[model samples]
Target chain A: MHQKRRKRADERRAEILAAAESVFAERGYRAGSLAAIAEAVGISKQTLLHHFPTKEHLLVAVLERRDLHNLGIVADMGLTIEAMARLVDLNLDWRGLVHSYTVLSAESVAEDHPAHEFFTTRYDRSRHALADSLRAQHGDRLPGGLTPDQAAPLIIAVNDGLQLQWLLNSRDVAIGELFRAFLATVVKGEPPAST
Target chain B: MHQKRRKRADERRAEILAAAESVFAERGYRAGSLAAIAEAVGISKQTLLHHFPTKEHLLVAVLERRDLHNLGIVADMGLTIEAMARLVDLNLDWRGLVHSYTVLSAESVAEDHPAHEFFTTRYDRSRHALADSLRAQHGDRLPGGLTPDQAAPLIIAVNDGLQLQWLLNSRDVAIGELFRAFLATVVKGEPPAST
Candidate 1:
């Protein structure tokens, strides 16, 4: 009975966080509120607070959920260019998530923003992890004189920039194909031949 | 007397727009207000309204002003790789403008955003102009079988993406040098030789 009750509480918390993600994505963190999140989850603010306690805590939870999701996808696919292409393919199915990530990241560039620490730390962690992973996998054999360290940031930048363009005009930009070509250039030390 | 009054009005309008740019840069467009802009320009909100009747109108004028400034710089610099590097160098002196542009562009991705039409049109115009200028200058000689058209978006993406990374970690990311190297990779079809 205790296990059953604990599972129910965990499920309710997840639902609240999910609602918070949508509200924050649509209205932005500064404009988003617990009241709106609670309404979306069909719960009272007090109940929502029972799970998150504060807006900042809820925002952190949402970001942590996304990080875990993203890391899982990458790990499942292996740390290859193919993995990145797959990520882009996945992005197409969830434009909301992409928008949330992009908006929060741009907003987080301000030093005082609540998400600043989250994103700065995120980039640092991702860049170093990717660099080390690439080194362990490919060593110095990568193309274009790109050390794993160099490729790490460039790859992350392209992933992000392409999403911005793609979100603006999805019909014109082929996110997966473009990312694949970028990866090919890195692997071959030259731009891929036009198809 | 009429001529003098008209010139003064124009000067005040310009001043107000400049202040708006700074405010929107420091706080996002949605969070920025006419009162703040007026305070920045040492004018009354009533006077600000005389120049730009609505917040959207002021936002549009601010964007147009920036567009004009950017066009003037690129025209003077001749649209070469060096020109792009020069732009990056220029960015170092105006972190606020860079932050404003980055934040606004990301926000403008939403269809209902006030800057939506402005940014969508801006990208279309820029992409076409860059493609045409590149073609006229480089002909079909671009590396990797890339037409000027193909390279335009990629270059723009890299430019915008690099700004984001640099903004987040200015001390570590050498924006101008990194851009120069990106240009060299395009020019030579390979990474530039180490100096």
Candidate 2:
């Protein structure tokens, strides 16, 4: 009975996170409220507070729950250009995750914003990790002669920039393909013969 | 007396827009408040309402006020790879425009967000214009081989994606230099020789 009760709590928490994700994505952390998120989950504000305690806590939880599958792939595969292409392909199916991540990350750029530190550290770490991975695999310089440190941020920028485009206009763009095209030139192989 | 009053009103409206830009950049449109913006400019909500009349009107005023110098450059130079490089150089000095644009464009991706149509049209026109420019200059295929429409969005993605990085940490990266490095491969020339 205790195990079943614990599972129920976990399920409720997951549902709350989903509600919070959409709320934060649509309204943003500062404007999105507990009352609205609670109402979405069909619960009272008191019960929602019992689960999250505060708005900041809920914001943190929603951010932490972002699908880290692509990052994990980067870690495992060592960020080979092809690996990035494959990873982007996966993001196509995860629209909710993409919208929330893109919206929240941009909103987090302001100083003192709830996720500001998280994003600052996250970008720092991602850049460092990518540079390290490229250096480890390609040895200090990528195929095109740029150093790992220099190339790392460009790669990150492309990923993020493409997300905004794809989020706004999914019907026309093939982000994975576009990313692959960008990566080919950076990674120092023959540019693809055709689009 | 009428002339003096007209000039003062224009100045006051510009001030309100600047305050609104920072407020929206920090808290986002839905979350950002008129009262805070009014207070920042040392006025009451009633006075602000008199000037703009509604929150959406204020949002429109702020969005419209964003510097379009970059787009203007693109138009004059016909999307040549070099024109983009020069364009990015200008954005580095326009940090206020950069922050508000980066934040709000991402937020506008949500369904029915007020600026959603604006961004959608902007990207569509930019991509079309770029493609037309590239095709006219290069004759159906860029030196690197991708058509202009194909490369247009990628260029945009890098510009935006790099803004996030720079907005977060301007200390380390030179977005213009990084952009040039990416453009080298896409535009099909020798990559920069050194970091």
Candidate 3:
């Protein structure tokens, strides 16, 4: 019975996270209210609070849920085109997660935004992680003559920017195909001489 | 006397656009109310309505104001690295404009958002314009061997994506430098063998 209760609690927590993600994705972090999230989950605000004490706590959980999926994709990831391709496919498969992440991260640009610290830290870590991976193999320059430091964030930017475009208009843009072609230019091609 | 009246009217319009862009940047389109924008502009909601008529009208004006600046940069743009570098520099100078555009454009991913059609049509045209420019220079395949159609939106994605990263954390990322480096790989370097 203790095990059963624990399992039920975990399931309830997940339901709240899903509701929170949808609300945040559509209304953004600041505008996405706890009340609206409770209503979406069909729970009272008190019960929702009982599950996650603060909105920031809930936001972190939502971000972590997505990151957990991404961890699976990028765990021990190489700078290979194939590894990055899987990450692209993962994003394509999870539109809700991508939408929430893109909206929250972009909105977090404002200095005082709640997610600002979260995003700044995350981008820093991810850029370093990608840079470390690139450095391990390429030393100073990738095929395009950019240092791992310069190339790492730009690669992340391409991924972030592509999602916004796809989110804005999925009709004309193809995220996966475009990402693959871009990786082709960056990861291979003859190393250019210019800065 | 008539000329003075006309000049003040234009100034008021510009003021409203600036205030509206700030509000929209912070709160997003759906959540950004006309009253808040009026409050920022030190006017009444009625006066704001008188100027824009409706929220959609205001959004179009804000987007167009940004587009006008962009048009000056890309009016006779070629697929050269130099022409694109100027645009990267242009965005770096316009932080407020870039923030608002990134926020609004990302939020407009929802089909029912006010700026949906506006962004869709604009991206469609921009993608085509970039593709046309690239095609003119490369015939069918770019220096990186991807067709203009395939490469065009990715260039846009990189620009859009880079802005969000810079917006999130200006400490580490350099938009202009990264963009020029990426452009170097795409516009020059040897024609790559792969897609």
Q: In TM-score terms, which candidate is top?
A: 1
Q: What fraction of the true interface does each of the listed models get right, in terms of native contacts kept?
A: 0.33, 0.73, 0.60
Clashing pairs in 1: none
- C-alpha RMSD in Å of predicted model 2 compared with the true structure: 2.3
Worst 10 residues of 2 chain B by lDDT: B184-193
Candidates' TM-scores? 0.93, 0.91, 0.92
Listed per model, the TM-scores of chain A against the true chain A are 0.92, 0.92, 0.92
In model 3, pairs of residues that clash are A161-B161
lDDT of 1 by residue, B8-36 (tens): 99999989877888888767777778899
Predicted structure 3: lDDT: 0.81
| lDDT agreement with native, every candidate | 0.80, 0.82, 0.81
Q: Give the lDDT of residue A195 in candidate 1.
A: 44
**Candidate 3 C-alpha lDDT tens digits along B47-111:** 88988999999999999998987787666665466778888887787888888888888777767
Q: Where does model 2 exceed 4 Å of error?
A: A75-78, B71-79
Q: Which sequence of candidate numbers ranks them by DockQ, best first?
A: 2, 1, 3
lDDT (C-alpha) at residue B15 in model 3: 99
